[model samples]
Target: MMRSSVRGFSLVELLVSVAILGLLASIAMPVVELTQKRQREANLREALRSIRHAIDAYKDASDHHRIAVDNGASGYPPSLLDLSSGVTDLNSPDGPKLYFIRRIPRDPMNGDISVDAIKSWGLRSFASPYDAPRSGNDVFDVYSTSTEVGLNGIPYSEW
Candidate 1:
């Protein structure tokens, strides 16, 4: 019988390819994880911005007397629910009228409406108005309570 040439990857070649693929995957996994983490941080940041804007709008209306200051209350809504469901008596010179946010945003991390229960969200009350040191009069700000620093080397609370 005549010798025939075979056209196929050698064992060494196959092994080398698999090794290269494994190395690539190993190198890529962490980068992918980091990217995903960063994206989550960005989402949290955006959510915070939206919530803060809503709070400010409420405050502005209150300050202008367009909306009542919840009667004997020193600040805005005590809880996130207050912003959504709680009613405010707006003394708009017309009379004491009721007003409130149509809805409160769901915490992205917690995937729920109640931030306190989840404990994943941080509160920035009227006293602190910042992420660090949870000391405050009332909840003025909200942030992710996650202590893990992000790929950016910044604390999640700071995000």
Candidate 2:
């Protein structure tokens, strides 16, 4: 009777396979992390954009003297909460629908949605440090609170 030999990978082959896998994992890990970071940054950007847009809309209406202006808080909502809670009847001189953002988004890096703490999204109003509301009113200034380096070789705050 003739004996037949079964083939199996050698120890060297197994070692080489393991080495390749390790190398691949090392390469893939960074890419995955970068992708996640970018995604978060993108989300933060979108949130900021949404808030800014709402603020601008409010400002335009206010410029036309359509929306009522708040004296204590200025044209901008007193707090971020007002964006969601709806402006008080006392705050609105023109109408009550001058709310900016429906709900503030949490900072991707810090995951903070609290209205007090400065984060990514900032509402545009006369008090805002950036864009003023039409004339002197600062509509909004969206800035990333994150100090981490973004994928684009720029800091999140700079974005």
Candidate 3:
């Protein structure tokens, strides 16, 4: 038989490798968190935009007399559901139903799609003060219910 030699990682080398991996993981964690925050912020923007657009459309229809609206009431929809549930056409009582949005998008900050979308959002009625938004008789505006500060250094609710 001839002498044979085999090489394997020494304890020091293995420890160094683990240390490097730990360092890399530490550096990567914040980046991953930031990326997720940005994604959620984008989703929040899209959700707000969609809901706002639907509210605007409802108001427009009400203003144009295309949809029946209560006298002395703001043209805004009474509830977000009203947009998706369909509204009656004032032009013809028997006309096809008018719908604004097919479905209400969930609040991205909450990330709870199972919950009611209306509950997930902070609603502002036309009668509510802009500085202190609150859901009331109608849905004039929508904001994220999250109090978390975004990566942009602004409160998610302010966005």
Give the TM-scores of the predictions, in the order they appear. Answer: 0.71, 0.66, 0.91
Q: Model 1 clash pairs?
A: 68-90, 124-140, 124-141, 125-138, 125-140
lDDT of 3 by residue, 52-91 (tens): 9999999999999998778888989999899899999988
Evaluated with lDDT, which candidate comes out highest? Answer: 3
Where does the lowest 10-residue lDDT sum fall in candidate 1?
111-120
List lDDT for all candidates, in order. Answer: 0.66, 0.62, 0.90
Candidate 1: deviation at residue 2, Å? 2.7
The digit string of per-residue lDDT tens for model 1 on 88-110 reads 45554555434455555555556
lDDT of 2 at 78: 45
TM-score, cand. 3: 0.91
lDDT (10s digit) by residue, model 2, range 1-159: 988697999999999999999999999999998889889888877877776676666655555666556564445444455556664343455655656667776667665566443334433345434433222344354566667778778876666
Evaluated against the true structure, the overall lDDT of model 2 is 0.62
The lDDT, on a scale of 0 to 1, for candidate 1 is 0.66
lDDT of 1 at 142: 76
Which parts of model 3 have CA positions greater than 4 angstroms off?
111-114
Candidate 3 clashing pairs, residues 3+ apart or interchain:
none
Q: Which is better, 1 or 3, measured by lDDT?
A: 3
